[model samples]
Target: MAKVNISLDAELVVEVMVLAGVGSPQDAVEAVVRDYIARGHRTEARTELTEQSLREVEATPQEPQG
Candidate 1:
């Protein structure tokens, strides 16, 4: 865990706490940061899978219908 001193808007912190259902400002901030990081990982994984599938399709030979 890391600790840092920073300033934040009281109203915004309260709103985030309420929306996130967290009791502490620290918890709310941590939850939002974790969620943001997880979203990026998911997006990267999806992009990699899509590229691999496209490559496989391109490499496979097509059959002609008479």
Candidate 2:
């Protein structure tokens, strides 16, 4: 496989390591890049966040007996 060079914030790297849950920042970068390249940047983060927000809103029904 060919390799390319890129830069990212150290904090962001740490966060990715934690999220990847493999205990290695190098592995996290490789894993993320592989998936991102394969998916061609296709993402649903916004839609998932919207769905989560809606679910939270619906779960907290307004109290009428104030």
Candidate 3:
């Protein structure tokens, strides 16, 4: 296993530990690694950014409704 040194917010770490039923920070980190490797995360970011730009171009100024 590749060893990585990273930091997590204390609250978030606790939350993930409780939900995941993991015993230690390493376990939580490993879970994240497994999930991240299995599911690539970047494609959606690009897609969302593209959609937002398109919406900005297409959005028309709306008249305030009474």
Best-performing candidate as measured by lDDT:
1
Clashes of each: 0, 0, 0
Please give, for residues 1-66, the per-residue lDDT of candidate 2 as tens digits.
787788889999999888888678778998888888767644576667889999999999898995
lDDT of 1 by residue, 1-66 (tens): 778877899998899899999999999988988999999999999999999999999999999979
Tens-digit lDDT track for model 3 on 1-66? 677688889998888888788979779868977888756657677788999999997797778999
- RMSD for each of the candidates: 2.0, 9.2, 7.5
Total residue pair clashes for candidate 1: 0
Rank candidates by lDDT, best first: 1, 2, 3
Q: How does model 1 score by TM-score?
A: 0.81
Query: What lDDT score goes with residue 63 in model 1?
Result: 100
Which numbered prediction scores highest in TM-score against the true structure? 1
Instruction: List the candidate 1 regions with Cα displacement exceeding 4 Å.
Output: 63-66
Question: Candidate 2, which segments miss by more than 4 Å at Cα?
Answer: 1-7, 41-66
Candidate 3 whole-model C-alpha lDDT, 0 to 1 = 0.82
